[model samples]
Target chain A: MIKKILILSIVLSTFMVAKTPKEIYEKNCVECHATLPSSLEKMFMSYIKTYSGERDTKIAIKTFLKKPDLDTSVMSEVFLDKFGVKKPTKLNDKELDSAIEYYFNQYKIKGRLN
Target chain B: MLVSRSKDINLFRQSEKVSLIRFLVLYTILVASLLLLISIFYYQSQEKLMYAQYTKLLNTYANSQIKKLKNLHHYFPQQTRYPRSTKFKSAIYDSEESRIFSLLEKEPQYFDNKIYRTDGKIHLVHTLDTYYLGAKYLIIEVDEDRTWLENTLKYILILGAIAFVILSIFGVFFVKLFLKPMRDAILLLDDFIKDTTHELNTPISAILNNIEMIDTSQMSEKNKKRLTRIDIASKSVSLLYQDLTYFALGHKMQKKDEEIDIKALILNRMEYFFAIGNSKNIEFILNLEEVYLFIDKAKITRVIDNLVSNAIKYNKRNGTITIDLTPMGFSVKDSGIGIPKDKIESMFDRYSRFNNTEGGFGIGLHLVKSIVVEYGFAIKVQSSLDVGTQIYVDFRSKGYTL
Candidate 1:
């Protein structure tokens, strides 16, 4: 009876803890982007920092994700032909705001690559 | 002699009441219709604005998620589909419009509009530029919560009801204010008629009484004929005076409802009207039944008097008049100059005479119609050009139909 109750508690808690946006980012975004401070995602953010302001860069990231095609393409044509454009998003307002905030903080180049 | 037409002062207040109700009904319809039209237009614009705001919010949410998907696919070259979102339900479709994977149980019914609504929920289907996870159509569904709209509609209806009541009250006040002049004019007419009727009563009685008392035993036969002519003319004037008197003071007079001997009343009216018909060389054929009616005596007498007067005044020389009274009702058929078919309906309008050939005030039938309506009696007039006229009054009333 005790073991059954313990199992039930674990199941209930699992349902109770709805994934936060930061958690969602780590699970969904970090698999290919990697967790290091020198991933390709970080490199792209550094390049975006050179030409775009902080809010513009963040907004650009969101706009490109929403509609990725030849017209809004940042990658070369060769790469575009190989990988194609990204699909549309399914995040609600609460989840999307949290995810964007996570992306802004994670890949931001605050220090030198020494 | 009576100075003017047979205009009843007692009916002035009744006419005012009728006009007051008419003005109120017409004014209310105009105000309410305008208010309702404006409200409907406002509600439609408000609905459009609300939907636009909702769509903008959904687009912002979708755009953020798309960014996250792009980041995931950039570094990971072998990725197919990203992790599913837990916050809201959505579905994705390929370029062929086939569903890839959805949090929904089934595919959506249509993809025609950028925004679609289904049972108590809003659905936004946005086209994607790129095929991340091989998706072309991105659909997001949210539960509809329109308590604000419902509240707005409720407020509008409440305000409309209050406005309607307030406007109606003001309308009545203004209509009454506007009709004050008309009422004063009618009052002046009544006062004049009353004064004239009072002054003429003494002279009329004097002329009639002294004529009755004059010694005609030793008078010349030619002078006797002249006196007889005067008597006939005076009696005709007396009938007109009596009709006017009843119109003026009849309401003030006490009325008692009793079982009236209708046959006796007809016989007396015929004898009294004998001089009138004889003067015109018109003949009266009365087929009166011994029917007893339970009503006011003065009103019945006025009705019969008006019908007989009309028959005599409008008749040709040596023409015939047929008055038939049965258990059902009575009819006055005249063998005289006929009324036009189109003018028959206008016979009951006060001072409405088709031809001015005869001397009359034209209020006889108007008074008849008023009494018939009061008792819920059905009246019909049938006439043809150059043929004759017949007026039928059906006394069997269920109630006032109008």
Candidate 2:
């Protein structure tokens, strides 16, 4: 239809070209969390999967990232001592949502194992 | 005279009505618009606030449900469906929108943070994490009554009404206060006019009466000519004086309407203005008819005096001033300099004289118009430049009883 072409042409003309959530995660987040992709996602999902639901898990991760300290960390004291605590992220809300979505899609154990 | 003065007051009131209407319309619209906008914003914020409270309530219920599910999972691992909340109906779904556990049978239409209504119930959908046992979406449905919304709107309506009443009172007071200066000026002008006319009454009567008492036949022809000039000049001033006196005492003027003979009254008024016409050698052609009219004598006389004198004043030298009267109406036709078409419309306005060469204040026709209107009659002036003018007065207006 004419509508589809017009929309496509507008997209091309504007050239907004936003990065995908995965690409955004790799670009801004992976360097600090892990040298390899999916490493942080694996560790976070193992702890988060025990929560009441996906919303609770997403909220917990988001809250922890906002102000990371020993009290809020889900990791064992041994792991926390070895890896160190996570500092506040420089990423804004949009980037954070993208990165979190990328983490969920990449390494939630149910999705990866199934 | 009272009729003439009332017309002036009517004119003043009419002029102010426009400004009053403009102020009221703009003021009310502006106020209403502001109140409406505020109402919209308040209602929006109220919606958010109420929902926030509902979300907090739902969140508490959600946490309790989560804890119950955790214990149920720990002990009853073989259980298939998650437990439901007793406070409200609830359901859970997987990522594919397939219901994993639900209390209600029918599924919701949309999944968003805001509440939606369906099947006579209100519900809100929330996404929960920690996937305690694999559920992605948790929906909370409660039977919501509209009494709260109605109460909110009722409060808004009351607020709007209060603002409208308060603003309207202030608006009227402010508008009137703003026009106070203009009202005072008009009142002061009216007072000055009454005092001036009151003072001119005695002197004008004295001049007219003494001039009448003079024995003109005993004087030399040359002095007689001078006396004739004085006589015409004095008569003109006396006519103006009568008009002003009637105008000043309009409110105090007595009204005594009775059956009067129109034929005699017309002839008498003709005789009254004969000398003024004679000064210019203007001839009178009378077509008087015997007609009875129920009217005040003084007001009708003023009307006739004005029309006849105007014909004489504006007539050419040795021209004819024709007076025609029927049972229905009368007309004063003159062989004189005619009025321009543009000037005729405003000729009935006080002091709106178009013909400046004539010696009189322009109050005559305006006074005549007032009396005509009062008596339910119609008058029209037809004129063309350099040809002539005809002033017609019909006894009855269209749809008038008499």
What lDDT score goes with residue B142 in model 1?
Answer: 74
Candidate 2: list runs displaced more than 4 Å.
Answer: A1-114, B1-45, B63-83, B90-125, B129-137, B157-172, B215-226, B279-281, B313-318, B337-362, B396-402
lDDT of 2: 0.76
TM-score of chain A, predicted model 2, versus the true chain A, to 2 decimals: 0.69
Which 10 consecutive positions of candidate 2 chain B have the poorest summed lDDT?
Answer: B2-11
Docking class of 1: incorrect
TM-scores, each model vs. reference: 0.61, 0.63
Q: Which candidate is the best by DockQ?
A: 2
lDDT of 2 by residue, B1-402 (tens): 222333244324666888889989999999899899999998988777777777787777777777765564343334445576568888766555656566754568887545666776667787765554455677877776677689889999998899889999999999889888988787777767776776666776787788889998799999988877887887777788788877666546777888888789988777768888898898899988778888888888889999998888888999998899887788999999999999999999988899778767788998999889988899989997777899999986643323
Supply candidate 2's per-residue lDDT for B90. Answer: 83
